[model samples]
Target: MKDKVKGLVVGVLLGSLLTGATAFAGTNTKISVVMENVKMMFNGVHKSTTQSIVYNGNLYVPAKTAAQTMGESFTYDGKTKTASFGAKTGTFKYLDEVSYARIDGKTNRLYFKNWTNPEGLKFTIAGQKYLHGIGVILDEPYSYDDQTISIDYNLNGGYKKLTANIGIDDYTRNSTNSGSLIVKGDGVELYRKDDMKGGDMPESINVDVTGVLKLKIVFEATLDNGRQIDIVLGDAKLIK
Candidate 1:
């Protein structure tokens, strides 16, 4: 079955490539093209299709078919004659690109990057360094009190996924540092990790944010032998 499916072919078109090869058939453009059956596959999996073509040595298929095959959404508007694809897929928007509604329960910090410095935060975890994402010190030096940082985003129900690499920065990797990470969507907890240490590998976070209007991430650190650490959310972004 796999062999037969792998050989499945769609139509392909090939023809002349002359400079004056400009014409129209009915309301659509017409050109000298050869139609053939071509098989398509991705990652050893067959991508079944009924209509496809080869034009100028390139394969062409319906935009909707291609997009859908890649797990993306596609839409067309007849009245406007417009097409839309990949609204909540195959698109990533950095969290820093937009303004947040609050930080640690205060709206005064409209600038999100201030928590990590203007140049952006860099942190090392698992022998690797990551750059340009939200990072903040969770605990104060010599302070026995527990500290927490909460960054909130007003998603406006537009995004579908949230992704980030979470970990403690190497600045305190050698110290007795520990913390908890929590992610919330619309006042509901979506993910949580307790007792994370600075020496641990970065935790890759990829959570569903569908229909989420308000997104919140909280990092809380406990006092351990007067040690401090930078809890980093590296390369954090929202997909829509």
Candidate 2:
């Protein structure tokens, strides 16, 4: 009787151990994270953050970090679950791969590729191709005197500023390529750049859009004796 009891106890303990191990194995889950390789610079300094992620083909950084990068302040209210930046207030929500703060009042969107003229031409230099449907890229060796591309935007009077990153991307080693960056709205000139040369850093431009109804960005290049004269309007948009 004693031997039988001991054997029964041992069997129960082994069964329990096996059952627990199987349950643990069944509950184990695996997760995958995708990383993107890209460099981001803000205000002439490199900005690094672990919370940056790429979701749905868009790169998103932390709200606070992004605000700080733009030299702006950020505050979050736990009670109302809202994020406030200056005069703008919005609710924050986190998704699987990205997070966003939806503005409470009004917003405006102007994507460069969406506003580019479709009838413009495309060019290629040293096996790198640039399409006009996306953004304006000018690189010609006196093939044309001047090239122009038009972009139109209709405003709802809620936006406060128009911002864009404009720069030159001259691949030619010589220093003969030059051009001017011009922006006009409704036949009124808003912005102009006449001394754009090769190997110049990109500069951020902001124009006040108080009561403007229409907006247009024109990229015109005056090329000299050079092989390539590239100018790109990088990530142009409107801010509210």
Give the winner by lDDT: 1
Badly placed stretches (over 4 Å) of model 2 are: 1-134, 156-158, 170-175, 224-227
RMSD to true structure for each model, in Å = 9.0, 18.7
Tens-digit lDDT string for candidate 1 (40-142): 4555677755355556776555565655555557676668666665563457787867677878732332223334353444456766666546766756666
TM-score of each: 0.57, 0.45
**What is the lDDT for 137 in model 2?**
44
Task: Give the clashing residue pairs of candidate 1, or none.
Answer: 11-52, 12-35, 12-36, 12-53, 13-34, 13-54, 14-34, 87-240, 88-240
lDDT for each candidate structure: 0.67, 0.46
Best by TM-score: 1
Candidate 2 residue lDDT tens string, 1-240? 222223211101111222111222234653233344444455457765433444445554455555555556766666876665444522211111122122111112112233223433332223233332223445444444335444555654545566555555434324465667776655588788776765666566877766666666666557533345555555444555
The positional error of residue 130 in candidate 1, measured at the CA in angstroms, is: 2.1
Error of 2 at 193 (Å): 1.4
